[model samples]
Target: MIVPNREKQAKLRAFLAKEAHALGFAQLRVCRARDAQDREELLRHFINKGYHASMDWMEETLERRAHPSNLWADVQSIIMLGFNYGPDEDPRQLLARKDKANISVYARHRDYHDLIKGRLKQLSAKLLSRLRETHPEGAIKVFVDTAPVMEKPLAELAGLGWQGKHTNLVSREFGSWLFLGAIFTNLDLLPDEADKDRCGSCVACQEACPTGAFPQPYQIDANRCISYLTIENKGPIPHQLRSAMGNRIYGCDDCLAVCPWNKFAQQASEARLKARDDLKAPALADFLAMDDATFRQHFSGSPIKRIGRNRFLRNVLIAAGNSGLDSLSCDVMPHLDDSDPLVRGAAIWALGQISPDQDFAHLANQKQDQETDPDVKAEWHLALKGKTS
Candidate 1:
């Protein structure tokens, strides 16, 4: 059995810190690959309550996610790394600008999965070389957000940061805007002291949620979350929650933006992860004009491209509906006959919210007979009912 070597481990830890900083990782720490019992129980409870919503993958990977050992049996050490991607401006300010889309700060740039994964691979290769010098058979594996790794809990265990009330890892140095990655290895390494939860009596994050997605301080119900509704849900967004979504066309960042700890956050260091000028606060009208080809070309390397044009347009129409801008009626009315049912449904809602009652009624009458999708037909019926009532 491999035993811990204090002197050798100290050297390895120092080497990792130096290497990680050179690779643009803001923080790095190590922990044992043991079972996280409390986290496992919490995850099981959350899944049992169906808080995961349409994300069935969370329930499916419960065992592998429950403990690092379950994922790779030979794993003895887990290294948690943090990459700060803090925005230069407060995202909450954009909420008041109803004409502009409020995209989450992280999604404003190149996908971190692409940026951080490559960096993780580079760091892993260097670590493997160092390990081979001593333990020639040492094995290593790196993971970004793709794997079923409980990155937050492992991060806290590694002393990288504690999971805040919003359930995202928060660092003293980087605050709420950090991207996490992990590396698991067979070599026995000394674990750092775990970070203690510092949040006390602050309900700012919970209060900032527009849809009240949090059932408690640390738990989130994915069903009502704007991020889940806009980015994850493939079907029409639930009608009841549409108005509360406001102008956020993509993921929402209210909770993250409200954290007082963010006062310490530094702007992102990597140029590739910086926010694009055009994406900062795009006009809702501009997004509604994007066809599939235009959307594919515009969001070519963006994380938003993954949601596809239809889903994206669905979100844009929702924002337009909530904008209360009657002048945008002409722009929205054209989408009433959109090929995609989700876009048509959202267009119906937007037209109802922004168009004159007579105009909406006339269009509804003209299109109602040809609307094939049950959901789109239901949206028209609901809009008409809402108008008359």
Candidate 2:
């Protein structure tokens, strides 16, 4: 009877793998729901060090995020899926093109949340339907990044990949380009062997960071990370980090792109995952000129749209500042009086980056008395004093 049960479990796992691949998932694996419980300490350590930055949700959902079992009492197993979104060319290549804004490779197309979640639900329904043939109580739930679930650790547990020194999952086959999604089910599934850490002593990812975000190997300081500063941060980019930011207007891909494991990476197969032509390397001037409506229409159906026009413009202005093109100063000038102080402050900083000192001081004197926001006013003073840091 036990042999028959084991055979049945194996068959169910095989069926899951088939359905997952059919749904366009690059890889699939299963693990006990509680397999990631040990990651709680790592999460806590990350939060304790203030590494999560302004993402306070991590603290709010600490317990539930630490263990999958905490998320659902009846969950017996977790199905982890990896969908490859590798780029055809190295994303780091854009870093040298200061005139073009470097958006992260992942954000160069449609948002992964919508693409992955719909497929997760479809797979869950199929799996649950199959399980119900034997156990009527079988049930399932699907999650992308919406929940507090520790996806990277769970993916590691499911043998999908090991979390690299950059603290992002690194797949030997897909490199650092796989997007993760998960399914939780009440039915028992045979867990696969967990993937061993293959990082060894490779610190290429650590050395690639422009902002020195890594305090040490395998840990990240979100406050110093360009991705966090550009995307999650709502205010001005730090003065010291702005020069290092270059023309990266959205998210940073340096660490992920520098992985030695990328030799095995393949171009993304999904049409929606491929980079859109215009977004791949948009000119800083083009982005600096966008207003709210234009920004929305341009980024429609994209993850970049979620950042809103003000924040998006703020990033563009930072890129413009780093472009070292006096031509962009004209494009950056109109934003100096933008309705949002965030944009105005960024414009002030951008001018400091490109405008002549005499011109910057004159403009600072002209705009000084009109500014009410202390932060914007402070920017004028800082720019006038040549405090680029």
Q: Give the candidate number with the greatest lDDT.
A: 1
lDDT of each: 0.90, 0.88
Per-residue lDDT tens digits for candidate 1, residues 1-389, read 24357887788789989999999999999888864443578789999999999999999999888888888889998889999998999988988988889899989989899989999889988888887766778778999988989899999989988999999998998889999999998877788999999888999999999999999998999999999999999999898999999999899999998899998999998998889999999998898888889999999889999999999999999999999999778788778878888899999999899888887788788888888889889999999988888
Q: What lDDT is reached at residue 151 by model 1?
A: 92
For candidate 1, report its TM-score: 0.97
lDDT of 2 by residue, 99-203 (tens): 899999999999999999999999988877876656777778899988978889889989999999999999989999999999988777888999989999899
